[model samples]
Target chain A: MLPLSVPFIATAVLSVLGYVVARKRALSVAGGDIRTLTSLPHQHGLNTALSTLLPPLAVMMVWAIGARIAARSDVALVPENPTMVYIILIGLAVTGFVLSLLRISTSFRARTASEGWIMGLLIFASTIAVLTTVGIVLSMVSETLNFFGQYDFRDFFFSTTWSPNFRGDSDLGIIPLIWGTLYISFIALVFAVPVGLFAAVYLSEYAGPRLRSVAKPLIEILAGIPTIVYGLFALVTVGPLLRDYFAEPMGLGQSASSVMTAGLVMGIMLIPFVSSLSDDIINAVPQAMRDGSLGLGATKSETIRKVVVPAALPGIVGAVLLAASRAIGETMIVVLGAGAAARLSLNPFEAMTTVTVKIVSQLTGDTDFGSPETLVAFALGLTLFVITLGLNVMALFIVRRYREQYE
Target chain B: MTDYKISAKGVQVYYGDNHAIKDVDVQIEDKTVTAFIGPSGCGKSTFLRTLNRMNDTIDICRVEGDIRIDGEDIYDPAVDPVQLRAKVGMVFQKPNPFPKSIYDNVAYGPKIHGLARNKSDLDEIVEKSLRKAALWNEAKDRLDAPGTGLSGGQQQRLCIARAIATAPEVLLMDEPCSALDPIATAQVEELIDELRQSYSVVIVTHSMQQAARVSQKTAFFHLGNLVEYGETDKIFTNPEDPRTESYISGRIG
Candidate 1:
């Protein structure tokens, strides 16, 4: 750790010393008159510090990547000595600091020089974020391609069965998983949308300030709870309640774990997402719109229903779509409440499992990476990613269009 | 007072701890344009909202005094604010058309009040209201277009049309021309003059010249008090309260 941190600490200390020493040199160059200089002393100091840090950082980054790749390929990178690498890095920092200090004359545009380095740093930071997302998608794509190479693509997509045995000649179809995903998500949305929207309306339009201030944060607290806890809730309380009261009495099914259990629990999990976002969107509808409606003799409810809600409809739809994507991607609640049985059935009380649940079950515990079952998780992930991506884009489009209409 | 179209006596308005409107009394006549001219924060808009009980919507706002429309106490427990607002319509400082088609914007008031018996009747009411508002010619072709797609001036007229579609007896306008350009302002002023032939039009304006041009009666407010009330010409020309004179001559706001 000391050997690793040594170069970084040296670079930092040198940059600080460069800043103070360069500022003094700049003042001396201007004959102690700041007004005679093209840039302020602080700007000259910043230029020196950035120049001291940037070159060594870039070299270190390149060296680290080279070392990683070389290790993977069973070869040592150039500049094999660790001390030699540290020497090169610290030398570069010293050279850059001295060169910038000498260049900080009375006519030097130090501000622009510092600004360019800062902009480059910002660009590097943003590029890391973008690269991470791109890297994830690329990895998924590679594994999915490997999956398709071994398993017949036609059977994986078109066949309804999803039985994966460790022995050969096992079926690895995705249709039933996709069906379960959609069915559960649909039931969740059906149960959540109206209840959430009505809650949003009550919070935004009818609830008094005291009630709103108390109730809003309490509802948002649901969003803060972990999905695993909600899974427990589904397992312990709602699943048994539904099975004993409704499913057994109606002769639908006797199983405690069913699609309805997971769907209803997922709906409970999603209520805060829908209601909170819808509340904000409804609140954003200008008070002037409500006043216009009310001034024309429309009742408060009438004003909300006819004018305010219509104006906020696009944003609410966007919110619902976002919640739908979340429901589709959910894993833990379905794992506990809906037993892992991939089946395509219209009866919601039947045991079922979603794509996310299967992906977890496929990849967890002892699993060889060479097998189709293991790689299929990546395929399921990529499919779910694409679906959610499409939904997010559509949601953004609607929300943006709504913003333009009002603003 | 009974003969007046609308009457207010000793009206006081408060928003939480802030006294927005002090003791004030004024009577508005039927089929006449009455202008309330004052500087900003003088409570002209607040008083206008009280005529239709629009202040009831503000949770912190409280109104005290006698305000009557057509010899009926509008603040009475038996008088529903929704029904009272239908009888006494209002146009806002900024034109706020419902985010709907032009035809739907005008039809909303009549639809909720159940004034139209059928489609043709609703169409006639919309057409008549648009024509009355002087928006018929420009908006006729694009009745299906969004009301927000119109220019600022056309949106104001659309609001006026929406207000009068309920066939209200009084129209309260809070600085209707403040957001319009000069040409649009002139058109709205001309439309206001025509609207006075049917409904009692009460306008609150910051511009004294607009008050003189469009109103038959003028009431000047200063520091939440009614300084003077009489004919528009007398209020503008003759000797009156010093504050009213200062406001008119641009010596003081």
Candidate 2:
């Protein structure tokens, strides 16, 4: 609630002042003899600045979080006193500044102190990112536990039907949503992997420089177009086209908003992901491998198929797995193209809904926060996160293994 | 009247706008070890590549005039380079074994060309080729091991075995012993001496001593031209060309 800019600006000015004071003090203490000091003047300056800034920043973050937690608790240990907190934080900063200024002598190893603080800052940055991810997972897990408390865990996981009722007797089975997600993702991969891989081979192996420069960018343009635009395209164009020409005429279900529509649109969206990654991997396979095969009386096609492709296969598989992970977490395209019907059907032409779509629907309106219906969204999110996380880990392992073999 | 296994007439090679090999004519004899020695950028490698049509893989490279093998025009429109390559096998300076097992690397050419009717036949060919390259004892037990896992010399010998497995009439080696240790080089040199009894072997070497030791015929190339071509002893002992004398005596490359 305290305007954060004021303290931030003050801290920055204090750091600059601290640096100038430390550098001048070190110089005077050394009697301008640079060789006699244990560390350089700049090291002293950096050490002073880090000491002046870091402690106050840490206290400010901790105090804010402590205030929030105390407000939530039955006993408010940290009283609602932002002004007092600000005063204490500034006092701590002033103390750090005085102590570090006093410590800047010729014999003191200020370089290590400065470097240690820099390392601490870097570690803090990385920990913030890691802790944010952990925090998200923890939040999702707690909400999901709450959901299971209200809804039977067995029915939520096992039952085939997903009929969520706001009247508290809901059949919130995850099976139907999972099936839709996997089936759509399967269809998309079946359409994408071969087409995308072949496009990669062609671009990497056959295309001339002129053609590749134009074509590669054009393929990447598909990646640059937002998923929302792709969703709209799916809703407007591909869904109806499939329903009329192929699905309905063949006596399949006549719904325009079918899994087939969403799957195909998603596949088109993922082509660049598969192709570009595979292209880089295939190109990375050394030209020496190809030359060796060709030198042994193998034709161009034979060399590529038996040698280059096999060598690049592991990296290509890794790219496909990463693309598969991306396809699983995809949401907007499913929302618009596949209708909002959480049904357990095998027919690609029939309308189906994924877990992400259900999550969005469950959380939209004036919903009770404690109700099982809204809580189910967290469970769905946690499930999706775990599934994608496993796929990503596997992909990374395969790519690292492949690189080790060649390198 | 013609005992030559290969012949070239007015062979000129161009890379894009630059003429790489200029007006070269050479007749390579059958069942003899011939050596081409030159400094770097001398087009000795380029002229050797023309014999097997390996230069065709380069987009900018162009070759003119006739190159014939066994008195047959290899550059004829009717000839397929794939089949031509089966007749003429090549080994590169760096040992580039395919990323397959040792057995598979040797079996690649024979399998593609249908040289074997069964697995045993293929295995026999692999064994015989390995033995011929003097690599049988070291690599016999680990034929299933990846070809790239072998030492530099063993890998080069494996490549030689791979080339010989197809039973090519001619072998082209572009500095085969350059990447090997002296011991491996001696082993390969001995193998090359034995190979001269069967296939027409043409080697391009930077080492003058290696050229003298292995070859019966030697060709010295300078710039983009063949400066001298004669018996190895004559090229070394009494050179008609001053450039050849200067090259052999380490005066100028």
Candidate 3:
């Protein structure tokens, strides 16, 4: 079996050769009068190269996938016969090159044919993305079904206690984890929304161009910082500060890692997501709207409140929903700032564990794949997926409905 | 001089060092329709915006010299531009109605200015403003409908109604009928003639025929200077300036 690089190099060299040969043939057919040909020489060359490239690459991909699937069933024959695979791929490429070369005539529409190939490639790339999402959901669904089969669905969903043991009597109720997730996300949104919205308004409406140019990218830099860095900041800074300053003094809790700590840090991480998107949405509200309000003797703040903000309300709602989904799915900050205690409590300062944090802890160490303890991660993940998906769909609906309101 | 509702003396406007409006002086009278006619970028709109201090919203734009509305310097630091704009309402080149109900669009100005004492007062103001703009018949039944849902002509009238609801002493229309059809243009021209009975109406128009039809007094501006200013009939018939006559005759804009 030859190395993978051999076929790749061969395909590249063959494609270049095919391009040059096809271009020369096209020019000769035109007899130096380039306008007589339907498509340009370069387009004919590109069509020939694409014909040599796409079909053999598609066949190789299919062969590789087939071999991978067959390998799981102990059928090693296909994977071991790489020589034959290479020969067939190379033979197909050469055949395509020669066939397309013959078709490059004075009247042949090579440009349209190459464009069709590019369109097909784009569609194929998008299909891979869509199919990957489908595959993830299917896998999670099957594992969740396994979890429900082992444990009663009602107990998994309804029971209040969550205590997993190695001896098989495990109370894996999802309510407490869901409660922690929602509670933390709620706190994050409560802290982030007004601050982010104000920042967006100031940047879009009030700030001069020079200030906006400097401030907007600086605010967006918050989004570029890794979430794990935010987690560390949560663990080292915000957690201790909240524990000593508020939680312990107010008789809430003594622990440094609490829901408030994680929520505050996550909110900091989500400010850019809200501000950048809201800024763009606010800016999209037409300048004419502002002029109309201002020309009617409304002050700047009054105009923003009564006219501009209302016009951009639907888009702002969508941005907030998107940020909410991000908050709900956040895991790194929760794992570090919020302690691993899946307790159903209303006190924000109390130590809590979210669905994402529990998903990480439940599957990290040694565990049987068939056990409900390990399979429960998939259930939690599926629930989170559905929640975020619902939020995204709602956001899309709001944005689309808002678009029809204006010209 | 006391009869002039708006008076500008040696007014100059600059947009980031581009002298948009050069040294210009004009006196606009009360209860009369004064039309500013010129080709595009002739500073007609810029000079109109100065009347209500609307150009104050633009950061790069700077206005110098005196622009007084009813003997009060509008650009004075002591005067609030918000209050000034309420006294002098403006309509734009395009129909820019708020994305709101027809009732709300008209009521918005009066509501913000505290001109209405109660719901009935606000309702009366909206009805009167709509009737004045000639939009009451088409819009009265659908007061709750979105203002943007109206036709282009109706939307322009709605904007005019919005501007009039504040009960401004001076109405500045910047090509208000440019976006309208010929029929709508005629309707708006008729409405403008009626508007002159109460408020000092200043309009910037591109069509010379429109200037002749709607204006009592016409001011021809060329290259940011007032080329001619007189009665509408005299300006259209025998303009003193060659540039004004050429512009009126459709030769050099």
Please tell me which predicted candidate would have the highest TM-score against the true structure. Answer: 3
Cα displacement (Å) at residue A118, model 1 = 1.9
Q: Give every prediction's interface RMSD.
A: 1.0, 1.5, 0.8
Best by DockQ: 3
Model 2 misplaced stretches (Cα beyond 4 Å): A1-6, A16-48, A58-88, A95-117
Q: Return the TM-score for each candidate structure.
A: 0.94, 0.91, 0.95
TM-score of chain B of 1: 0.98
What fraction of the reference interface contacts is present in each model, in order? 0.74, 0.56, 0.70
Runs in model 3 lying further than 4 Å from the true structure: A1-13, A27-37, A60-91
Which clashing pairs does model 3 show? Answer: none
Report the candidate with higher TM-score, 1 versus 3.
Answer: 3
* Cα lDDT tens digits for candidate 1, A1-407: 11547788899899999999999999999998999999999999999998898788777766765675576566877566888989999999999899999898989999999999898778767867886797699779988999999998899889889999867677888899999999999999999999899999999999999999999999999999999998999999999999999999999988888899999989988999999999999999999999999999999999999998899999999999999999999999999999899998888899899999999999998989899988889999999999999999999998887775653
Write one digit per residue (lDDT tens) for candidate 2, span A294-363: 8777898898899888889889989899999988988899988988898888799999989889999999
- Give per-residue CA lDDT, model 3, range A187-223, as digits (tens): 9999899989999999999999999999999999999
Per-residue lDDT over B1-253 for candidate 1, one digit per residue giving the tens place of the 0 to 100 score: 3679998999999999999989999999999999999899999999999999899999999999998888899989999999999999999989998889999999999999999999999999999999999999999999999999999999999999999999999999999999999999999999999999999999999999999999999999988898899999999999379888888999988
| CA-based DockQ, model 1 | 0.76
lDDT top scorer: 1
Report lDDT (CA) for all predictions: 0.92, 0.89, 0.91
